[model samples]
Target chain A: MTGIVVLAVAVMAALGFGLYRRTRDGRFAADAAAGDGPTTPTTPTTPAWTAILAAHPDGELGERATLVQFSSAFCAPCRATRVVLGGIAEREAGVVHLEVDAEKHLALVRALDVRRTPTTLILDAAGRELGRAAGAPRRDQVLAALPA
Target chain B: MTGIDPRGPRFTAAVTALIVAAALVIPSANLSALLMFIQGAFFAVGAYAGVQYTPTAVLFRRVIRPRLSPPTELEDPRPPQFAQGIGLVFAVVSVTGYAIGPVLLGQVAAGLAFAAALLNAVFGFCLGCELYLRGLRLKERLA
Candidate 1:
């Protein structure tokens, strides 16, 4: 009897959690640490956009906005995210997609409080973080989250 | 990096969720222990050897993948492998709990594992993978 109850509760809890995650997954939101709004300035020691470009010589920042994606080798959703961000970058003028290997950029990952892979940071031309999404974001969500 | 059919881990999670649920629900403690032990061995292989080497992945490749349409994309195997390690830890605790006098300990451990597996199987959410990344973040914070 106890086992049955436990199993039922487990199933229900898992279902609830899954549903909640589904709604939130890939939905870009303002960084929690930024507090109140998105106007927060980059930290004093925050690496410059130029530094990021220097690290990845092949990458280029967009004239208007840059999509910085932090991904790792182990994350499955990171692949889907890459495609989505890459497509957006291709379609939108003055927008560029930059992929950063999370494993290789430990300092940046920590500095940014990047909690997970497939984290996409939307940066303005000034290199200020506009927003971030922790999971693989949908194309529509990415579009909606972009600054007009 | 070697890519795998992302469905492989989901398939494995489904099987694991079922087996672990059965182990938790069945009336017989001995049977529960046996089921958990079997699942543990599967996790052991997946964690240490690689996610692709698991029996469930083999089954998926041979029996299941053939029937289904090709996966649109493949994923890195490291996250699932890390998840397997987490599962193995719970399996060990659950098995030991069943073997020892305090059976409740076993039930809780198995229950947590079942929750994680079900989440992955049904929603494709990887709790263990999330934990792995969180662990990295935590390590960085402390350092």
Candidate 2:
């Protein structure tokens, strides 16, 4: 029956998501294990931030700093990200705010390892890696990341 | 005889018909692929149209149309504007996917969307309904 097939696909997708989350979580833990505490891990292999920078014509890091957000129109978190990041961008005149539609840019998404909506990559004024957050960042975190 | 709400039943029947069609046609016919492609297109438009007419139908059916209001709570529960917004997004995604992607892949996305729509129609189990609700909740929390 159609219902049965649909149910099978749902089950498979859930399984796949679970496996991916586990693998990604393990990878994070391993990287953290190798790194010193409280230090921002920056590397060329972590090119997600780089691709994000390239998305904006002005580049990732501008005079103030930049918050590049990958978003989709249908994605709910994206709307929330817009609200949260919009406030941040408003307060910081130098911060370059940009958003890319994930659905439209599938290649960029896979290259950047962006699996979720509202993924934000933060960079310094010079475009160097600062950090990134998956969901909406706390106001304090955003403030802390800003350049003096 | 036990009474059943009309809109709910109608939605359910539509969903059932689509699913049955998909099941029967998939793997057996090429035209079935078109089903997947247009599934989201028609569903999003159809659902919007269905919801829009719900209230007016309720008014007419109970008052002028001579069907008495049932005791159950299955009347049109959605706000017209909200339903329309959701439908709009659904329709946009469906149309864009069909436009840009390979015909088969686009149809796959559409097929999946159609299946979800059917689930919502038949069982009142809307897939993205709660996502919007949660988005609103997040907005409220932030505010």
Candidate 3:
């Protein structure tokens, strides 16, 4: 009887663990889908956009284009993105790259609707939006997004 | 950081995941048992790690302790020892269930772990702390 009970417990634990993994996987997929929507609201009074642009007083607009990546120090993916972005920028003199520490600027995140880390916003010389990429854009994808 | 309960969130998530995983693993379930076992292992590790570390104790001494709360007759920040004792028991039982074989009783432990993890992650709450506090109260009663 004792042996039977032990067997029962092990089987149950295994079953419970399986359910949890499924739930977690499902939630991750859902979060990915929701990322595209501009659901998050910005702070009413803060002019975060203006501040961001003003902080870069050099006004050095890129000839290839500009890529700004918002990231946090502890985020692993952000580190990888930084390296990739840097390599891309080095190759294309026109492709200027910049990074902003997200933790220091919550206002900017809300204004830009930046829900996830490693969010890249691309802009042309005149500060017009060319395109944007969330998560880690593939090497080819990053290059492809560059303006000719 | 010394006293702060890291175990609460980790413990809850690991167990919750274990229970949900185990329940889905029916007789026909192929990969279910494997998944649950991994989660169960993580729970065991988390439970053991939580009690061993004393983040709150260190943090209090370094920061909060130095800046005293202006003499308001502060109660002890720690929860009862029994809470952790119960948690330890649960961890051992849950791991044992995983070891022997699959059974419904194992699910009960997994379910408890899952609930604990959810509360910790979503609300920043700690069940371990509650258990410890209960243990302390019991001790006081006995005294």
Candidate 4:
């Protein structure tokens, strides 16, 4: 009787957690303090956009939008995210996809407050952080997150 | 880095979930301890020797891979390997709990491991991988 109860509870908890993650994962959420939000006027002396571009000499900002992905060596979702973001960048005009190795860029990763692998930041042409997603985002979700 | 068929780890997780579930459902403590011990050995081998050497990986390579078409993509093995280490930790606690006293400790440990394995098997959600990444982030923040 005890064993069955434990098994049932474990199954329920796993299912619930999986369902919750599925609903939220890869869905971009706009930053409340970003864009035109009223927040503290104390902007960082070193902006994240400049720091990111400075770190990657080869990376150029897109005319319309940029998708910046932070990936580690061992993350499986990172591989899938690369494919999705790459395909979108290829198909869309003036959209750039840039990948950063989180392991190598610990300083930048800390600066950006990236908590996990395959985190993508959607930046407008001016390099402002419009929003960010914490997992492997779907292609349609990425499209929807972009500014018109 | 050498890439592996991503399905290999998932297959391993499925087997692990079944074994853990069995361990949970079995009424006898001795049998449950033995089952967890076996699973822990597998985890140890996978974690230390590399994921490719695990028994289920062997099964996947010899029996499963040949039957299915080639995978569209391959994945890094490090994350799944780390997951094995995490599984080994829980399995150790579970076996100790069942083999000694306090069967509840064993049950809870095994249950958590089972849930993690099920998540990986069913949803492809790698809890160990997430933990590993989070650890790195925490380390970076501290540094």
- Best by the DockQ measure: 4
Please give, for residues A1-148, the per-residue lDDT of candidate 2 as tens digits.
3434544564455445435443432121112321232134344344444566455445545577677777754343355567667788888888877787665665566665555655676655555445556654556666665656
lDDT score, candidate 2? 0.49
Error of 2 at A50 (Å): 4.3
Query: Which parts of model 1 are misplaced by more than 4 Å?
Result: A32-59
- In candidate 4, what are the lDDT values of residues A1-148, reduced to their tens digit? 6777888999999999999988988988875445442122233334457879877988889998899999987688999999999999999999999999988887788778888888999877777777889889999999998877
Which regions of candidate 2 deviate over 4 angstroms? Answer: A1-50, A144-148, B1-143
Candidate 2 residue lDDT tens string, B33-76: 44433443444543565543443344544554355455343333
Fnat of candidates, each listed: 0.69, 0.00, 0.00, 0.70
lDDT of each residue in B1-143, candidate 4, tens digit only: 88999899999999999999999999999999999999999999999999999999999999999999999889889989989999999999999999996999999999999999999999999988777667877876687
Error of model 3, residue B10, in angstroms: 15
Models sorted by TM-score, best on top: 4, 1, 3, 2
Better of 1 and 3 by TM-score: 1
Candidate 3, residues B1-143, lDDT tens digits: the string is: 23333333333444454454443444322233444555545444434544333343344346555575443222222322323344445545555555564544454564565455454444333445433323433454477
Cα distance off (Å), candidate 2, residue B80: 14
Listed per model, the TM-scores of chain A against the true chain A are 0.83, 0.61, 0.63, 0.85
| lDDT scores of the candidates, listed in order | 0.85, 0.49, 0.50, 0.88
Best by lDDT: 4
Docking verdict class for candidate 2: incorrect
Interface CA root-mean-square deviation for model 2? 10.2
- Per-residue alpha-carbon lDDT of model 1 for A16-106, expressed as tens digits? 9999988878877776544334445445334346556655778776887889998886687888999999999999988889999877877
List model 1 lDDT by residue over B19-91, tens digit each: 9999988988888889999999999999999989999999999999999999888888988898999999999
